[model samples]
Target: MQLSSFKSFPLNTLGRDFAVGDIHGMYSLLEKKLVAVNFNPQKDRLFSVGDLVNRGPESSRVMSFLGQPWFHAIKGNHEDIAIRSATDPDYMDLMLRIGGAWLMDKSPKEQARIRQTFTALPLAMEVQTPAGKIGLVHAECPLDSWDDMIFLLKAGKQDALHLEEKLCWSRRRFKDRDETLIQGLHALVVGHNVVEGMQIMGNTYYIETGAFLLDGEHGMTLLDLVALKPV
Candidate 1:
């Protein structure tokens, strides 16, 4: 589908979900963890916090899955840079240094698939549940002043600003526990910074388990939103 067509789908109503952290191209590990938790793709929705590609061996596989009807994703910093590089000539080299090289190595068919998928991802997603609304982004929000995330999203403010740092690269939101809590969103789910395991600071959860086996770990963190449990 075309990029515009992809974005035209309804938002603000993704119900009963599983939000996953940065996959970083670890397709096999992702599959294992999904099966481990008995994930039902048809009935249970899967949403990615972004960074679905790069840093591992299967960018192609990652892109293909993200494009599936059952899967949804936000635009992490890696994806932001990639989209920019794909359209901007000057930034192409920088993008390659930060995992674009792996994407570039894929076959023509794979490359086309990846481009189509990434081009369709949103910068963030708002999931509405019976309890409350949850904001899913690649990195946490910085200002902590905006009470209405939906307004910001509609105002075209979701794109990373020059001083804001890319959402995927900012450490400010993760380091300050008090700041995050004060923001007052029911829950903020993010990936990008890998912790020893999943982290819970107030209602916010960070699930970036470093799925690429970066430190030789064997498991991928999985969050079951409907059941409110982690496996």
Candidate 2:
């Protein structure tokens, strides 16, 4: 399903652009947050660091938002797991345990459609704002070069396990690597690992505040790249 390792968005041309963390089926909270921020469905764009479904409620409904022009998402680990469970017979129970049982509630046709959509999601998106460039990832990116990682992903060189493991399931780099200088990257925003608040490492930022927990000062990072604050 033609996927690009990188996507470029002109954040300045749009009314505004915001990056959000994993949803895990918390559509109601997402909606409320957007409304609070006055997210304009017609002009504003919302990018999700992809774990859009699988834990809270209304997974299918959240998937429907993909059809909207305002919503864009990268492939998160949960989507990877759901795709594997749908295609590989052995992973169904594992999917359910990790919050994919919502898939079982849908019809076979619905399931196929969802799988097709999630499977085609891009692994990374690069936003070129007037301020600087921001890269979106579901989990931690490879420790070294963003360019090298982009090349591997753009070429689609990974096997199924590696694809899921590296792009979706990795956190070693985030924990173990030194915050060295990064090239061609103004900021990197990611989800997957829940953070108490935004954690800044080198040029990277982790904004996954566990919105599914349904409590506290949450709702991901609503960033306005010009000022780099929540807009």
Candidate 3:
């Protein structure tokens, strides 16, 4: 909602600014990690690459954090589905199949609130941090050119799906990523494509840890934008 992009929103002024990995119902794990980092919510802030719901228990609980001033998230593929399936039965099967089963039990009012929350989420966010200028997207950013990706994003929705949907669902940029780089970008952070851990390719960082798998080794990958390291 902050016009998709922002500049000079430096983290130095805050307690500590962090970009968290895809939180597929890993709220407790995220809390633990934040505690470990000594995150002071009163002064700190968090930016999420969406997918805050689905594929894990307590997706509903995650919604509680959305209202807090310290938290922000972009639209994720799972959220895209949740919004679509809210009114259209066509997406119901796939939505549940991909971790939207929680929606099935929600009251109509609760479901509407969730839909409203997600529908308001931007497809991407760009900010200037102490580390550098960072761009956060649910999936990929045009590794070849940020201009190409921004063009599509600013133009808004499409016929079958919005440009945001394409951006939120893409994984193509990661293939052969060794050869890829976003010229002037300091870091283009993303989730959606789960990895063994946080992997950096050129200036792009892929941090989806698949916390929903409930694997002991997997949890949210919190990027310390202030320190430019994973916390």
Candidate 4:
């Protein structure tokens, strides 16, 4: 892990509303889907559910797309791992095992740019949607472990690292506990866990439709916030 001494990027609020699920390095598929949906990079905003890298053949390509101005992404576990590796020299080995190898395989200048981009992603985003306040996090909510929901909410966005484990790793079974029920946020959209199709669990939607699916098989779930529909 070659730790870069750059600061992380803050979360940006954009668009009337648009969202996409886990990319997992399937850059070509993502490009086609964006075209199929007639995505307008300027007027329409794009939100990634996370896991923008790893397990796919083109992590470098995936990062390049994410760097575009039209994209707004929260930090997924993969990004978190890369960040840690980037900042901590000791974790370099771990990073390589995950997806660092692919990222480093790029040209020197390309790798440098990717490192800068990764350093700047936000940990989570809270969007005002018709369905109530929809929170876009990587995976689960950190509020699960806290007995006081108000306290966690008050912590604000600065505490991303403290909540990393749950935000970027927890899955459906882990989030469907009594703790989550008591926390009472409107809905949380996340990725990391692959599903057969898009899932609507309570108000939270898991949209990682396994973009890495091979054999000429790949799928993505697009969420239209205004229409309250997933296509």
TM-score of each: 0.79, 0.90, 0.87, 0.75
What is each predicted model's overall lDDT from 0 to 1?
0.66, 0.77, 0.77, 0.65
Give the distance in Å from residue 157's predicted Cα in candidate 2 to where it truly belongs: 2.3
Against the true structure, what is every candidate's RMSD?
A: 4.2, 2.3, 2.8, 5.4
TM-score for candidate 4, residues paired by index = 0.75
| Candidate 2: regions farther than 4 A off | 159-164, 215-219
State the lDDT at 97 in candidate 2: 81
Separately for all candidates shown, the number of backbone clashes (residues 3 or more apart, or on different chains) is 0, 0, 0, 3
Best by TM-score: 2
Give per-residue CA lDDT, model 2, range 16-91, as digits (tens): 8888888888777777788888889988888889999987776767887799988889999898888888768778
Q: Model 2: what TM-score?
A: 0.90
* Model 2 lDDT at residue 124: 83
Point out where model 3 deviates above 4 Å: 1-11, 151-162, 215-218
Candidate 2 vs candidate 3, TM-score winner: 2
State the number of backbone clashes in model 1: 0
Ranking by TM-score: 2, 3, 1, 4
Spell out the clash pairs found in candidate 4: 1-92, 3-86, 9-120
